[model samples]
Target chain A: MDRTIAIDVSHLSKTYDSYRAVDDLSFQVYAGEIFGLLGPNGAGKSTTLRTLITLLHPTSGAATVMGYDTVRDADKVRTLIGYVPQERAIDRFLTGREHLQLLGALYHLTKEEAAKRIAKLLTLVELEAHADRPAKTYSGGMKRKLDIACGLLPDPKVLFLDEPTLGLDVQSRLRIWEYVRMLKARGMTIVMTTNYLDEADQLCDRLAIIDGGKIKTLGSPVELKIALGGDIVSLTLKETDRIHSLESELKDRPAIKAVRATTKGLDIRVESPEKALPTILESANRLGCNIEFIQYNRPRLDDVFIAHTGRAITESIPESETA
Target chain B: MAHYWQEISALTMRWVRRLSREKFSMLFTLVQPMLFWLIFFGNLFQRAADTQVMQAPNYISFLAAGVVVMTVLNNGLAGGVDLLFDKENGFLERLMSTPIHRTSVILSRFIFVMGITSMQVLVILGVAYLFGVQPATGILGVAMIVLIGMMFGIGLTAISMAMAFSVKSHGDFFSVLGFLSLPMIFLSSALVPLTAMPGWMSFLAQFNPMTWAIDAVRPLILSGWTEALPHVGMVVLVMLVFDALCLYGGAKAFRRAMG
Candidate 1:
């Protein structure tokens, strides 16, 4: 309930029939911070963002954005927030300038004010050259830029972006990331949800990794990577059965914390992969097994997800009747 | 009230811009109704004349009033499809999240449809005049007919938008349109006189709001406002009921959709 909290979600739950899309979720986003909701597809990240934006009502619990209750004060919430959905919502029939002007009108800006904002926003998104072209004529990156420009028309206090870079190319994604950073630098509060681990790592000040409609972990990127221990040693064995013996042998080792079987090989979380790898290789060789591939690197957000959820982030989620 | 006017102006401008940009699509929309008025109605009235069913001094003028009202109703009702398209394309959600008054969304659409309908009415009226169908009264009566036609148009627009919000598929829209149009046109004295119909048919016509609207305006075009004030009052009352029902239903549907 603090006035400084840009977003306050308290034990929010949303259910579709017997399934829960967002389950007993609680989080707070501070003002002027870029908060990332990181999760794979169907992990309820979008659901949580939608609830905060007042697009979908939660079955239980409550959320407030910029000190206004999402449900009770929806109009006020709308006035204070800008929502950029996953899909490009710009009218293809309308020019980019016209689209922004119409959106500006919806925000109650007069003609002169709307024109000024439209010009500024189009330039900010780097779409000024193509401002008069219909949105249908724009490329994917241009369309996305226009979408962002539309969201910025109101100069909102809080902005909710759901998978903003989902379908963009690498260069366009990087461009968008730069814009997001600029927004953060300008002291705007942003709540963004993305399945892209790299995006979360690059743009988010703090992120919450959600899986199965629950927050698996929450912290800054460095904090999360630190929580996974020292380093991850990935070893591809010639035989899958060798993983169990390797795990059994390494379980009591001083440098290793845990060794689990991965699809390509065995992943060992250790205090120091550099020191433990030589011993692990000697042990594997003495056990008469050949190592196909071996790699030791810092833990990634994907590893953090696998460590907590016991599944790979890239795997398709099993279908449930969850809304 | 200023906010409402502002919203209306904003929405109206958006629609006008869109129509101007998509000239081909706009032409397709305008041509169908124009053809119905110029070709189909013209031929149908000519046949009726051969049979003496349409005994008015100028059948084309009588038919012109009905055609204008019909065009306005059809265009207004069909405008909800644009809302449905906006919803499907995700634009509606974006709009809903804005600070604009929600009622303005529907009202803007009504204003847009009414404007388009007025343009089409003028074109059809010009064509009717060229065919030797002259209005008995001057500009005031013509303006009154257009006003009543627009009111009825707004009501249908609201009802159509309400349905668009409730129904999930485009197929449902076509089916609903087909079902509503024939019954509404037939129940009114749009194509023929109530006296020429059976007793039950005439009774049904009396209850049809379209009948009241057509009757109120037909005299203005064919005989001037020798048409009684009570007749105009009846049309206005019926129009008020339909307008209220549609506005209420559309707003309710919109709230549910937003949820």
Candidate 2:
């Protein structure tokens, strides 16, 4: 009921027959903030976004965009929000300029108004030179930029971007991130769903880490890292056989909380890796185990995900490829 | 309704621009049916006239009506393929997310298909005139037939678009539309008159809506609306029912697809 809430979802759920795609999910995106739904594939991130944008109906509970009910007042919600789907939703036959023109028209812009907005959006996305070319001719990044540009054409108060940079090159991803930041700075409330941890860390003001249709945790990047307890000391051992000895030796160390063997190496969550380094090395020396690699850093989103879900995000992607 | 009109205008403009840019698709729209008419229908009519089975004044004129209607039907039904492609490419989802009225999407496609069909009809009519088939009606009457024929075409298009939403793949949709169209064209008086067929064939033709449409426009092509009014009413009623069914089904499908 808060007027400052750009999006308010309460116990919202979506079930396809017997499968619950989104299970009693609840979250709020405040005005003028960049909120992220971070998850792996089939984590219901896209479904959540689709429901918020009124593209899909939720089975239970409720959601609202800019104070309008997503289901009962879909047209109003649609008018207030812009949705950028995970798959590029552009017409290949239309030029970038024409695509924007058509989208603007769909948003109820007059001809003159549409044309002016098209010009400004083209410049904003840095696709002015390629505006006249068919979208099929655009590079992956160019297509993504144009997709984002189309989403912004209505000057919407809330924008939902689902996997905006899924297949983009690093440079293109960074460019999109920059534009997203600019939108937030200009008082646009953005709900972006991304599987990429680094993207959420860099762009999101706060994030909800979702997995298996549930919210694992929700906090700012720094808050999440701090919640994971301490910095991580990751090491790649020369011999896999030494993992057991390493775990047992460092298990009760004052600076170390947990020592687990991962595919790459042993991951030791520590209060202070800088202080724990000498002790860890001495333990390795005692065991006569050679270290192939060692890294000590603050916990990443992936670590936070692992701490909550007990699985890596990358491996959690459904292998079927069809969904 | 105003929003629907605006959507139609915007979509029509988009199609026009694309057609202009592509050039070849427009040319294809004009020439493909002409080729079918010239080869298949022309040869059949010539053979029928030479054998003295055709008692009508001009056999080519009789065939011309069928060709024009067939062109409209073919183009109208195939227009749904664009919607299928939109689904495949994700444009449908984006369009659904906007504030535009849902019926406007269907109307826009109907308008585009109708426009393309009209141009094809002109080309067929020109060909008919060239082949020594004189129109019994004036230009206005001929226009009336074309407009009525286009209404039927729009109805078929609505059905096809609805099918696209209901069916899973483009190939499945094409199969269904093809199956429906071929039998309707063959059973109706498209290629030959019902009087020339057996009693059971005539009975089948009585129920075929295409038969009514062909009968309705045959007079306009042969002698104009004075004699065609009864058949025109029959055709219009059939088309109205088809259009209503398609619109209802398409709206349901649209809602399902969004879900």
Candidate number achieving the greatest TM-score relative to the actual structure: 2
**Candidate 1 lDDT, tens digit per residue, A1-323?**
35477888999998877788889999989999899998878889888987887878989999999889988998899889988878888788888988887777778788899988888887899898999898899999999998898888889999889889988999999999999999999999999999888889888888999888999888888899999887888899888877787768878788787778876668888888678877898889888778998888799877887888887777778863233
Q: Candidate 1's fnat?
A: 0.69
Clashing residue pairs for model 1: none
Off by over 4 Å in 2: A1-3, A241-261, A271-291, A319-323, B1-4, B48-54, B195-206, B223-227
Please state the error at residue A182 of candidate 2 in Å.
Answer: 1.6
What fraction of the correct interface contacts does each predicted structure contain? 0.69, 0.77
Q: B78-188 in candidate 2: lDDT tens per residue? A: 878888878877888888889988767777788888888888888788877877776677688678778877878877787788788878788899888878878777888
Global Cα lDDT for candidate 2: 0.83
CA deviation > 4 Å runs, candidate 1: A1-4, A16-19, A110-117, A237-291, A318-323, B1-4, B28-32, B48-51, B57-62, B182-188, B192-212, B223-230
lDDT of 1 by residue, B47-139 (tens): 456335665764565577678777876887787988898887778888888867767777778778888887777777777778887767778
lDDT, model 2, position A266:
89
